[model samples]
Target: MSIFKTKSFWLATGMTLACSVAGVLLAKLPYVNLIGALVLALLLGIAMQVFPQQVRQTAQPGMAFISNKFLRLGIILLGFRLNLVTLARAGVKTILVAIIGVAGTICLTYWLSKKFGAEDELATLTACGCGICGAAAVMGVSPQIETNDEERKRENEVLAVAVVCVMGTVFTLLEIGLKPVLGLSAPQFGIVAGGSLHEIAHAVAAGGAFGESSLDNALIMKLSRVLLLAPVALIIGYWYQRKFVRRSVAQHQPTPKKLPIPWFLAGFILTSVLGTFLPLSAVVLDSFVQAAYIFLGMAMAALGISVNFRVIFQRGGAVFGAATISSACLLTYMVMMAKWFF
Candidate 1:
């Protein structure tokens, strides 16, 4: 029987659901949740190989849309967990470090991508995703760029997800190992991990590995980093449009109208601000946000399964190099700021 049959569909769906549940449950554990989620995500990726074609086709369009849309919405809801006033109390230095880390990561990654022989579009997507907020960053910029080839677009998506998974896992393991070995303070570890991890979830996991205080600090730092997404997207969009115009003029083709900014990003910012003033119950809001995040994770896992694992491994050195250099620079910057300012 073809793997695309009903059994395969149900099996894949079940596995995804299981992975999501495991991720959330693990997240609640004292120190193990982050590593658990990373392991589970990887296992799900490997299990996805059983029905390769089905997983790829399933992950293509719907998974992409679900991962992008709900993840943004989730980030908006996550704002409720934050106390803007408290963040302000943490002072401007914390904010400055976050801004520098985000900007530095993007610039460094772009330079590293060129050195690694990555395509421009892929490099841009990878850098933004790594620099700002993972998958959401990629989604925000996708509409602005014209990726006419579906295959190339798929390749971009795969690269983004693969990097996030690998880097997120490494961050978690590092947090787990370093917290005990170095006897680092919660705030110090939080600053280091939040600055380095590729995704917010990974930051949370790393923070949790250190304890509640570290988790709270790390989440705040990570959110501050996330706030950079809008400005970064705007700058990238502007630069992309400028390049497009130059190319069009050089080729004697009519320049297209500029693409509208992603409305969801604006909504995310607005909701975050509103969350500060709203009287909503934390239980209800937290539950909703948690659900959204779990769904986003499953969608990402499904997306991961779609990648050609062999191809990714073949190009592993370059990918690892880019991620390592970018993360290292960001981490170093954050640590220096934390020492100087905090």
Candidate 2:
């Protein structure tokens, strides 16, 4: 087949790009986003899941590509916004805050969820989703969590939805209530929200709610936290690989291979390093950042489209609850960290 002569390819890609455009449009609505367009696109995708037969037949491959490949491209482009000099001079506090917040959330969430009797996969997924970059983090770490049972796989899927949903609600509510309750300054609250919130959308929304400075503070903190995703994945992968190896040896089963570093992390770092020296115009850099948002929206939509709501509700209610609790705890930790840092 000639490269330009495939019906399936055109149809799938066309659908993906169209969805991304819709996402971009929706992002323009006023007061429609305490959440970002990425989340709105996700909601749209989930809504479309009710018509899965048509979607599966025509658009599955392209959706998968956007969620995986395009998402990685966005993460790399994201790096263009960060420079080492900026990171060193102004970002140190935010980076420290992000590290403590993300790292603590992961460990605490995992332990708490297990204590509450969630499955290993459910616990792990919840921790990553809440601890890192919401849907994106969950997607990044997902390659490592292993389960043989059909029920376990389903639990993982439902838990992802649960994590996203809970964070969405909580982060939104926090935007309205946290400052009043805590009496923190805008920058302080922005730091807390960005470090602690589940999705970048939530953090940005929260920041926007406060003002431009808050928005900047929140984004810087959130992106710094995102920078941690690679290290977290490596830690999780190496630990899980070791644990799985020992267990397989005991059961006389073939050991599984260790998880590799996700390629996007490398690209992300490359862009960040290049950004320090690129001297690109602010207009050009802004365009890259804007495009990254669209790509991320499409990726989120792809995940939402894959979910089966009925099955998720029936099988993963308790798993969802566990994730919810884990996130709640993380929010509390984030608030404290923010107050101290700011």
Candidate 3:
């Protein structure tokens, strides 16, 4: 039977949609925008774990479909949010800072996570979330990591996102408080915020706290880091496939027939290029971006439903520790870079 004919699939999909819509609505409440729809949806889904086993069983397939398929589609549409032209206008100094910051953070965070006893896949997801665009980065690179246990993979992804979100919120507050004492110019603070914060929203909030110039610089620096997602995803995919292929050979299992194709990533890159060159109106672009966020929220809700809170509690310590330390280091590095370059 076709997937569309499956009642359980439709039921699960409806649950995700309902949760996502609720998230979006909650975000519209005064000051609730700070939490954002994605995280809200994730929380709602996590709350669903208390539902009856029969209900969970019925929703499992559709939840998996939404988590994987909706996620990729959201990421593909997210490409439209990037305007290379705008990033270029932010200048070479901004670009360099973003590159160095992302690369350094990823390396540092991964090493710290490993030292804290996190597994390889968990460590990698945590690193990507810190170094790139937070939850989106984690979700984007997660599919590349070959894991026989789907639950384990989703759990890692959720843990990584939670760490990033918590760290990002803490740093956002820190940046705001420190801005008055740091005595840096608006643009300098913007660079620091954009380069260090885990999520784009975090950067925006921190940057906006200073001034308009800070917000602009922050967004440019943040989006510049976002632009690197494609290349990073490709590289990780290659490395993971090779590692898994070798493991399979050693165990006398059949190797994968072909290299994995990241069609979603390719679509992202293509969409970005077109958005940069095309004469699209701001309203149209913004609409597409909003749609992407909704889709991502739905995916997050689906992923959250599969997570066991007890498991998260057990593993949270090392992951959170790695993220906090790495975030602090990244903040210091960004401050130094801003003072020296901006």
Candidate 4:
């Protein structure tokens, strides 16, 4: 049967549209704007999972469509938002801050998760999600790592909530307490905020709350970390081969196919380059960005539909704990680096 004719497809599509719209409306509200549409979508998706089994069954295909298809498209379009000139204005120091901050978070989370004996796949997925761009990174990295389909689905469901909630918590605490607690100047805090936050939206919200100068610098720095996705994904692909593929080959088992560097990364680079040359109108760019965010929210909702709360609650605390600790360390690292180097 054609996917278009399936009830499941339509159900998922409706849910996607509904959740995305709801997320946007929520983001427009006072104070809630900082949490952004992505968080709202994640929450909305999780809430939907509480409905009767038939509803979720009917929505499965459409939710998968949103999670998989919509996700890749949004990641690619995000490239159009990157500008080399903006990155340049933020300076090399801002670039370093992005790189080191991301690296530190990933490394720290991985080590901590391993020490705690979490599953390897779960640890890596959580690390990438928190260290890079939240659910997008988790989804992108999922294919490259060694895992069964069942594990991937669970990771998607669990990480969707775990990662976003951590980011929101971090963003909140920073906004509420960082400046006064750390006694950092505005420009300094901008670098720290840009470098430390996991999601671009969180960073943008934190910086934008400050002022224009801090927002500009923070966003540019955040984009620099976004660009690192290509290299990091590539390295992860290679590492997956060494760790999983080699072992399977030696054992004469079915080996995993080498996942290529995601095509979306190429699109991102191309768009960023093109953006530096033939930039679109600010209004047009903003529209595209908003569209990307809404699509991502829809994808999160789709992913969330599959989550088993029983499974999530049983296994989520360790991963979120590692991420929270990593976030704290990253914030400290970013502040010290920004003060010392910049």
Candidate 5:
């Protein structure tokens, strides 16, 4: 049956659209904007569980479409948000800081989360979210994980997103509040916020407190980390494949065949390259950017509906602690790097 002709598809799509609009509006309000539109949409998605059982049963296919198909599409569109030219303008020193910060945060967060008794999938997801672009990074790397249990996979994804949201918001506010005490110049402060924070939105909120130069440099610095997402995801995919192969051989089990690299991720990289080099008009670029936001909003909303709150409550404490420790360390590291490099 045609997806468009299915009543359930429209019902589910309509729910997502309604949630997206509400989330965007809520994000624009004072104080609430700190939570951001994506997070707001996620919260609304979680609330979808309260609807009638018949509605949920019928909506399953459409919801799955948004979660899987829209998610990849959103990630590809997200590449348009990155401009190699702007990232280059941020200077070599700032770029190096971003690179080191991402690497360090990932290693530290993953190791610590594992030590705290997190499963491999949970630890890796949280680490990626912290090291790169929060929920987007988590979602991007998720498909690479070699998990037989689909429920467990979705649970970890939700937990990782929640951890990053909480951690990112905490650091965002701290950066804003510490601006007076730090006494750093605008660009330096921007570097610290962009290099340290989890999400682009977090960096914007924190860096924009300083001024225009701060906001611009902060975005470029954030994009430096964003640009690394493609490479990091590829590395994770390769790592997982090798690890799974080794496990299969040890157990004398047949190795499962999977793509060495996710096709969607390759598309992401290609889109980024084209967006960077193409002579696209401002209007066209802006439209693409808007589309990206809507797609991402819907994707996040779909993921939110799949969240297992029971699992989160059961395993959250240790993982949250791991994320908190990693965030604190990354923030300090960025501060030192910013002071030295700037």
Candidate 6:
């Protein structure tokens, strides 16, 4: 039987299986769960690429749903893992550091995007998404921007996934390999990993690898950063609208649609808060959260496979520049905070 005939089912099955095996393997390793997930995701993508037609026809829609809707739900579920009381305990200073770090990274990445002349929408998406919360940020902002051309929108989506997958993995590797080699303390590694990694899963994985203390610290720091997504999205939308209006006036065209706020973000915050008070069993909570994470990993792997490797290579410079600036700035801020506070 032809694989393309049952593409979606098989594709989902393949990714789900791959992520499960990868997750298990990583969990067993000492301080390497996050690194394992990242590596497995890339390998899965490469495997899909080698069987392009089979993956394209079978997994495309399933992957789309995962990347779009399921990814957002996963992010919201992640909020449950966060402890609001702990966040409060971290106090105003840590919150301030997180805000400053996120804002500064976004600004730096935006500047780098302009410097590189990267595609406007893609660059803005990367800056906000990668700087804030990876896939969740991208989904939150997708509705605000108007990309009338279906092909262009698809290209942008692919590019967004590619950037997230590649950078998320690389950041995980750095968290595992570099922090210890540099003699970073548990708290230091937590701050660095929490601030610098692109996705919550990767951050959690890195922190878990570091140990229990690092895991707790990193999750809190990462959640604080995730909260910045809404404000950053609003800022980007405003900037884009102003630029669009100016260009429209110059060309005598009508203004674009007003940007919509993402309701999922509000839901995420509320659910996280609610989770704090509910006192749910740890087994139940962990089960749901782990399922969501695995789904996200599968989605990311499928999305990464869809990207044309050559195009990624061609635009490698832009992606590299954004990744380097964002990662470096985040690491620098963490180092500064460690010195000042820890």
Top-lDDT candidate index: 3
Pairs of residues at least 3 apart in sequence or in different chains that clash in candidate 1: 26-33
**Candidate 4 local lDDT, 58-154, one digit each (tens):** 7887777677778777777777788888788767777777777778788898888777767777788778777777666776666566555764556
Model 3 residue 175 CA deviation in Å? 1.0
Instruction: Tell me which of candidates 3 and 6 scores higher on lDDT.
Output: 3
Give the TM-score ranking, best first: 3, 5, 4, 2, 1, 6
Over 1-342, each residue of candidate 3 has an lDDT whose tens digit, in order, gives: 877689877988888887888987897675565566788889999888788989989888888888989999999999999998888887888778778888888999899889989999999999999999999999999988878998888889999999998898888888888987888899999989999998888888888877899999899889999988988888888988998889999999999776677789999988888889999999989888888888998899999988876788799888799889989998999889889888
RMSD of each: 4.7, 3.1, 1.5, 2.2, 1.6, 4.5
Q: Rank the candidates by lDDT, best first.
A: 3, 5, 4, 2, 6, 1
lDDT of 1 by residue, 1-342 (tens): 543455545555565566667766766676555444534554565566676576557545544454455445554554455566767876787788878788888888878987898778777777887787666566555555565675556557667556756776776686567666655678878877777777777788778766888887887787777777777777777788888888999999998687557566676667666766777677766775676556555655655555555665555456557877887677667666656665
lDDT for each residue of candidate 6 in 182-213, tens digit (9 for 90 to 100): 67798778877787787776788888777888
The 10-residue segment of model 4 with minimum total lDDT is: 151-160
lDDT, residue 40, candidate 3: 83
After superposing all C-alphas onto the true structure, candidate 2 shows an RMSD in angstroms of 3.1
Model 4, residue 142: distance off in Å is: 2.4
Give model 2's TM-score versus the native structure.
Answer: 0.85
Write the residue-wise lDDT of candidate 5 on 9-110 in tens digits.
788788887777787778777767667777788889889878877887798788778877888888898888888777777678777888889999999999
Candidate 1 residue 3 Cα shift, in angstroms, is: 24
Residue 208 CA error for candidate 6 (Å)? 4.6
Instruction: Give lDDT: candidate 3, residue 213.
Output: 96
Pairwise TM-score winner, candidates 5 and 6: 5
- Pitting candidate 3 against candidate 5, the one with the higher lDDT is 3
User: Residue 136 of candidate 3: its Cα lDDT?
Assistant: 93
